[model samples]
Target: MGANFNLKTLTVALAALSAASIASAAGLDRSGQDITAFLQDGVYAEAVYTYLDADVSGYDNAYVGADKNAYQQGNKIDDIAESYDFFRYGVKADINDTFSVGVLYDEPFGAAADYSGDNNFVAQGDRDATINAISGGEVKDFASAANIVGKIQDKVENGGTLTAIEQAQLKKLGPAVAVAQADYNMEGEGTNVEVRTENITAILGAKFGENKEFQVYGGPVAQRVQADVKLRGTAYQAANGYTMNINAGQDYGWLAGIAYSKPEIALKAALTYRSEIDHNLNVSEIFPALAGAIPAAATGMNGEIDITTPKSVNFDFQTGINPTMLATAKVRWVPWSDFEIVPPLYNTGSKADPTNGPDGLSLVSYDKDQWLVELGLAKRLTPALAVTGNIGWDSGAGNPVTSLGPIEGYYSAGLGAKYNLTENWAISAGGKYLWFGDAKGQIPNKFAVSNFEDNDGFALGVKLSYQAKQNFN
Candidate 1:
């Protein structure tokens, strides 16, 4: 191979192979936080959009019988995974041959899951099935208690007075009556959770080598996060009516990286590190079912919840396999095990129990860090057209994951194509299919509540990009 090879033309063909990507993985990671746009030869800009849809269903855990002595599998849970989408934009320019600056915007982290159907994950008017499953059939007849309470209410509302005997009965059955009424009031409700986050990063880089083959870059990143959660159904027991609203919060972080390139071989490599961003969000929580035990939970409390998105490292590399073919690889690591979300009031109430002590439970936490690897190949079929294919694997955050997002990890395959409308403009499209790993769903305190298996999903993306060529010599 000669250094005289048309590197600029090759760059255009290979760039599309990396254009429209879907890196849907564990621990709320989306978009893959790609920064390749900054590495292009000259002035480059791109806009990308990605959409993901998943089908996640499972079986709820239940008591073996009225005795509730052992756990058993219960009703079929409906699909909880919701379709999600996000956008990304990046632009970079050489401020001369030695200095370069760029900015990237993306939605980097998020989750969405909603549950419904006749499973324990939903609340119904009768609630008899829910109670039986949750209580091991011991509290057999909720209808009888409901009837007695209803009669007392009817008499009082009709301008009648309660007899002494009736009053005594009311006192004895008051707690049970309250629970039934609460369940009734929440008829047809289901558990749901949604979280969203965004990031904007700015970078300044300097090329140093005699041939300008080496570069170092560093910059600041700003991020915003928000979330909403609702827990319903007997599946949650005392926490059944729990709800949390976290207002949007913005914070800053840093990014640094080093890169190397060889225009002769059309080769490039980069190692990037992103610092964790912390957001102190205003949070409001209501735990209706825990009202009596935790008065603050029932009345709702407002406080601050500190959430730090995990730090990560990414290695991206690509090289020409031949004149018309390019090989690419990506490896990413995220310390998901160190990430957790804990609500102040919830933690305090949990610690009120001697067994829980000071290290109370978190609303969400992962058991392990995540590792993801992807490999791909792209071929320029024509001067204006190129196609690419890739395979990937993700080591999930861990098994027995949060019931809110129960997936372990995924294996995926994808295909993409790019078409150049002109020498400086291109459009790309890609699609990926993911096979999700089976996992047990868990709640706070490491309690397993459901089993999900054989779930799958797909992602689609499109990108429009522009680039102006430059000589690497």
Candidate 2:
């Protein structure tokens, strides 16, 4: 038999490692939806802060002709993945031996990426190139027609009459002038996007069975979400200069879970499920390049964008390997394939165009579900010190994913340490390094726009926690 050691005293030592888990997986997943704070044996509270940074650089595709049958590697895209940070807090208390309540707060989903190099994602601002590209190399003839139409329009607006030749030119120019004007307004910043979501969960747990070893918990969750997007450069072709603003919207969802624990051996296991949340938010969209085809798109349109965040399930388990060591495993699954964001005006304008057909397109979507798993071990080296190590793998949503958030999935390794400040308080810190998978960035119509390879990122986190054990003596 192994040496006799009370494992309950070391339960909180390595738990802080959850704070360092990076969120750069597919489909805007963040926070990992951790609920371990609610599983503590007593009154517990914690505050955690995490920072993540990714280096995602790639090459844009350069295609000639309208058919886009062939392409060559174009300009080098600089690192577009931006560094970001967020916070999490949780507090739980045992109402009695058989009842407990808790509240958890975290930013569960988000994205931050911006393109700034001289790549195709950046604005070229060349009038001739813009017209030539849109007109299939008919710059000379198209410019002449646009000039004639412009002169006649100036005269009419200035209280002057057009010559017979100018009137004929105006009639012949027709839609070309509108197209040219729309192209001229396309000069702006490069492609960029930022999305954010927050979740606050309130839970109530009931313990039952002999010795109260089993528990069932459930609660309501309130979520808030918002986003901003801008599309630029010739890489997007006719859809360049598009922009969207999604106002923040708040909604409600739910979470349910069951847990089993054996305190003598420090064994605890929990399976949690979170329902999907739908947000009907007001959005503003501008797609000037489509003005000639859908005149209403030039000025901009305001409508509702329906976004459904994916449902997810998480499993957390830990058991004592010996008196001074513990082993842990975590598994998570998210149905990213069922998630999508569709802005009303943008989809309508896309459908109105002959190329997009009747069904139109979603602003963003994933091709597959996501699965993640992590395994770890912890060792208490001293009475007040503990260390932990973990390795993880994530199966991304899919390759050829949306350009806005281009990373597929990642492999990661991490290390953490905790030091007790007193019997009831402790501080923990950890860091993780990630190796990202190669991917092809795509747009709504399944068009590959860029390629990313050999990228990596890192994450850092710190947590402070307090706990007071319940007395059964």
Candidate 3:
């Protein structure tokens, strides 16, 4: 096969070419659930690093009162820019021609958001509607009374007589002015959440046939989750300073998949399914005003909440256009509607919150499933260099997504490169630009918004691999 048969180059070309993507897809999913590592042909091990940055903007908060329209005008909220870093490691070995085993480690689901920006979304304040309106009204009446008093005083000094009504209005000026000078805004706090997940997969599989081979694999997956949510901001000012901390919980799930390949033409197709993991998380909550209050904390408010991460399926295919060129395609589906983040303590409503949420008291959730697709091509420009490019589309899970995790859909493109430093070592790098589809910024109690459209994201990644020994047989 000459130099045309370098397996190291295949790893580099497919480093960023999984067609399974990361970031801006759906429901805290970053790693696209790729299990292709188990399908590698020989003894292989690699470490990968990825950095993602997302810039989200165009936010609007609905204010409901006589003062609603004026307060939120020009409501271009914070540009939610966040940077995330991730690393993954994997090792696969073929004990013999028809049997293989491997282990993979990665951060499968996560989210980090800091609403601190030019917007008041995270501002520390409690500008109550009732208080602001009452005080503002006082100021309006005070100005009228003061103006009349000033005119009467000037007339009397200039030797002009004043009416009885004018004298009465003058008497009200002092107290009215005091009421007008009162303060309103309290402070902005809360309105944020953080999530993280880790996965470890152990696999065993067998291959059959000599020409177009067939293989099947299955494994147990262990997953862990953690979260911290601060309930403050526009709609949540009612719970303004409340916070919830979900202790990390680890559990087990499973996965199964099958693959077929024609190594000579570099063609392979595979399908995989990942099962859902359920967590009954131990949680602690803090609410400043509710401390030691009647019928609040003494009732086990800091106990547990049930959370379920959704299941998903993946299909991946790749073929060699020629000995030096490759093409690939992939599709994925996730049932995000079944995913939820509900705090049990918050589920019981108070007079402060009459609505328990029509969809349920969710700190994070979606109303629909997610669909994603990707296509790509790779070419070896020389024996030591290879380049690849791909395009992708994601059908968002919901049109009006929650403010906690807001995005509808996205279209993306990426470029990747690999350099073979030696027969045993290789380096790979890639970057992708994602155009977020327009979204109707939604808040529970179902606030409809035409905001959060045309936002964008960027992802960059690199990988290093080592091949200890080769099949020189």
Candidate 4:
């Protein structure tokens, strides 16, 4: 029975691995080639974990906020999103004196959790009232202008109305109402998504003439992916007028690259480019008991949503400054502008057939393009020990962003060390600190509310490796 249980666990693990590969291929970005190469150098197996925190505050009414609210509040919401963690394991094998292969399992790209509460209400008061009136009322004449007036009248009677004595008072009241409506919309509340990928890469490398100062390698790569997405909170529930279930999918993709290294000058550089993958996801639009409250036309399927992962480029270089010190630098570019996930028929430019989803709403394009830069230095403490530190910066994507994900840029610092345990064994450890910058978006005439705050976090990693007894011939 114990053996059977072990086998069952192994089977489940394999299935999960397969699903992760597919999901990675469909929507993930694999651009940390240098880091992967460092892990593939053989002589050891390593594990690394990373955590990042972002505080996105400020309201400009030019973009979407956590609550899907269109108004802005003077005091931004202090949103604490779900934390991020990743694990990686790798091994290297020599096919001959000049050829070798490496395999790795890790999460290259993933995102989960968004803002919560009625944060958006500070920005989208009018829109929220409009929607509630259309959906909550017995006479659902959404297209009739008279219905809007009736809703306002209802609000006035219910003491939800705004009263002003002069232009200044009216101005203040208008923004206040807008903010309330925005909160009522609450589109991004309790939204969470997770994606993981497992990769297998093969490489053939060769050393050049005399001193073995130069070496080059190239390989073909494949990956699988798995993903899960969930929507919660009052905003989503209120907007749907029904309870909703989590949505999920699985997919796959491939990668390839070549690298060169020189030991004489203590310099190494490599370039890697990953291709994009697409997923034909099977998504479900779950409905809760409140679903019965909305009209049947607004309660069902929004059709198929297409999620296309983005592609990226990575470049890394490192060199020794002297016998006791070394420096390393890296850069990454991602074309987020092309990133889009549109539910079919919803935003197809036709308003007559409202069959796609509520009010023909869609995810549309993200229109983001960004870059990151990193620099590090290492010092040799002894023949068997070394220590290193690094700092990095990420540029912000363009304004008028459309994706639900918040935040602009990040600043990070980290430390790492290596120690020789014995003649054939060694150990490595690393830690990082990340600081997130503020981000702002617009919600029209409503109040502007920041979704998060300026925040920071740390990461820890360790690796163990053993030198082979003899080189394979």
Candidate 5:
């Protein structure tokens, strides 16, 4: 029993490590464009390198306490605490002094979680029960354990026959089995819950007046999104279980934004707005060996998943209090309500019948509209060097419910420095820390359960640039 416990602990740790590695491998968006006014000029070209690291810890009770064989061990999972790093490079240039264009290449979104493996710490009976539920009896000879347990419970409630030994076993195994099954189904048959998105955007800005005090900028933006979705564990049969590998596809989308800034009166303010984009993704499924039971309708499953990324508006203001001192403030409004994931052409009839069809139809939804505020101060230490520090707060989305999303609100603080290597060249480096708030969600099953947790992380960034002397009148 002691050896068993040790092995179980090790298994859980491995599982958690695998999950964290998966989550961090995608290397999505780590930092936004620098808010410094000096980099906004049309005649300069800049390149930036950013590193983002995060430690995510949370429980997903989406199916908690639902299965007869499910168990809960403090809602702790193996791969909850993980870290990720991202690297990005971008370039901006001025064309003919009136038009400015820039391009950015980076990973914008990614997710990773793993629960299917032989080393899983869950007990054999509990794992088997959850697998049966998710496989939908696709496996032969499994006896549909969940169904059997449900029937047994119903019989007991109605005063059915049960020997003393049977009664004792049921009482001893019920809760643990149920919780373990819930965890298994969640790790195996639950939603793929992971995503990886890579995006590239091109921007253009223009100045109207010769003095260049006033300007208007807008441009077309395009992105290519790739999604790798996994099938739930319950969808697989043990003897001849169905195996669905990662589903990957690319979609094209576009956006546009406009901004204006003025810098003469020791005061500057700019407003920018961006639009949303949509993706129609195509998905395919692969079957496992020995399951020759492919129905005629299963020949070539083709479908689309619609995704609308969010849009946002940004406001930035700055003032010079002294020759070498400056203060700045920024605010952003993001339309989270518009965020949604809708699968195309769901078979409602098939979903209604668990015995003869696929998993039920469901869509990904979130109430995520939010606001971000930031304040910073900068000081020029010498003719060739300057440093700045800032703090920021992000309000939680009105509705903070998600199966795999870890936290809702965040607090961040950062420091940055710039050094002029030459009259026309400069370099900058910075780092930031983020604190995330806890979040909770429920899993739909016979037993409605809840899961909650929190997360946090840090980010580092560097920039290199070359600038031309200002052609001021």
Candidate 6:
């Protein structure tokens, strides 16, 4: 029965922590490439449920938030992010002595945030849900405005020659200054953004030749993606009432890998490569200001961004330390630089043409690829109990992170345990903690931000597994 289970507690611990604790790997990465699917034996299935109670403090609207007099020194955005729950299930079967097949259902990538509470981002007194409507055919015009009211204030106070009529305007300068200040602080309450992706993978594997020391596996992966972006606060004043909802879309990719194992001492090593998938997502882009002024198609003009999820490489190894102990390690790399999501027409016609993206500026872009490593130890304490612990590190996707996610890297540690309820059934629990690397989020063409640097996260999970008739001998 023990041999039939073949479950690795370390993998579950890593997955729970990766999904819940690692803020740097938060967006689009829920699983840490755990090989639990392949670890299952004949007619075996397991279900895992995870909950992440994560939040960040000290996040501030990037626009006029820094001006102490306007927003205050301790102007912070708290709990902008709420807790989340995730689940995954999989089954594996042994077809014959040398062949096996498996299937998995999992949420691979997702992101969420809520800023509906009271905050400093909203235009102090102009707390309207929708302000400064930007309609279709005027998207570029609106994006190019670049704080026109503030510019006007500058001219009114610093430059320009005016007559008595203009001099009269000077008397009402207080109101004009207030309006300009409100525009500069557009990042408002109710600003929220969410993205989700799920995957289904079918796998085939075989072990043959020389006492079945070598194993090979490959699979086809299908994924679905959906997202919604809302611009609210004072920092986003120019884009007030702007909402983008991307329709759910499905895409396909492939995975292949090989492994070499020596069961005598429980030594195993494997390497897997996954292909990138392209998605031509259909979306509805709305500019509240131009709701009826422009045709629907013109506002929805966006088939250009073929959202391509990045490819990745995973290598894992484990060796028995003693009759009841094992040492394990893994290395994973993702080319995040090749992945970017920039809504077409959002910032079209760049004032200063960018070298990478022709779409003016990207909604999100990674400056560097990601590299992650893990080291762990697993021990079987008794016939019914087993424990696993691990520590991990991840080189985040970028250095100067974007305001969207301000993590540059992370360090993590986790622990897990499993107890056999019966010979064929087991219950498990795991938890992880992550220390996020400090980062200075920057707004293109604007000043740098430093509020999300000292953030952290935590994750916990539970799982249940069952296996058909098993053979321990």
Candidate 2 at 374: error in angstroms? 1.0
* Residue-level error in angstroms, candidate 1, position 326: 0.3
Q: Which candidate do you rate higher for lDDT, 1 or 4?
A: 1
Worst 10 residues of 5 by lDDT: 13-22
lDDT agreement with native, every candidate: 0.81, 0.82, 0.68, 0.46, 0.47, 0.62
Considering every candidate listed, which one attains the maximal TM-score? 2
- Candidate 2 global lDDT: 0.82
lDDT of 4 by residue, 39-74 (tens): 233343444444444344343222333334554444
Residue pairs with clashing backbones, model 1: 66-136, 66-137
**Structural similarity to truth (TM-score) of each candidate:** 0.88, 0.90, 0.80, 0.66, 0.67, 0.77
- Compute the lDDT of residue 107 as modeled in candidate 3: 89
Q: Give the TM-score of candidate 4.
A: 0.66
Task: Please provide the root mean square deviation of candidate 3 (C-alpha atoms, Å).
Answer: 10.3
Q: Candidate 5: which stretches are off by over 4 Å? A: 1-39, 59-73, 78-82, 112-128, 131-194, 231-260, 285-302, 344-363, 398-400, 443-450, 470-473
Better of 2 and 6 by TM-score: 2
Off by over 4 Å in 1: 1-5, 64-71, 127-181, 293-296, 352-357, 470-473
Global Cα lDDT for candidate 6 = 0.62
Quality of model 3 by C-alpha lDDT: 0.68
Task: List, residue by residue over 150-184, the lDDT tens digit for candidate 3.
Answer: 78778878998668766554443422322222211
The residue-level lDDT of candidate 5 at 33 comes to 27
> So what's the TM-score on candidate 3?
0.80
Poorest 10 consecutive residues of model 2 by lDDT?
171-180
Q: Which 10 consecutive positions of candidate 3 have the poorest summed lDDT?
A: 177-186
In Å, residue 66's CA in model 5 sits off its true spot by: 6.9
Candidate 3 clashes between residue pairs 3 or more apart in a chain or in different chains: 123-188, 124-187, 124-188, 125-187, 125-188, 126-187, 191-232
Which ten contiguous residues of candidate 6 have the minimum total lDDT?
A: 130-139
Best by lDDT: 2
lDDT tens digits, residues 33-140, model 2? 899999988999999999998999999877645554344688899999989999999999998899999999999999899998777777666555555554545444
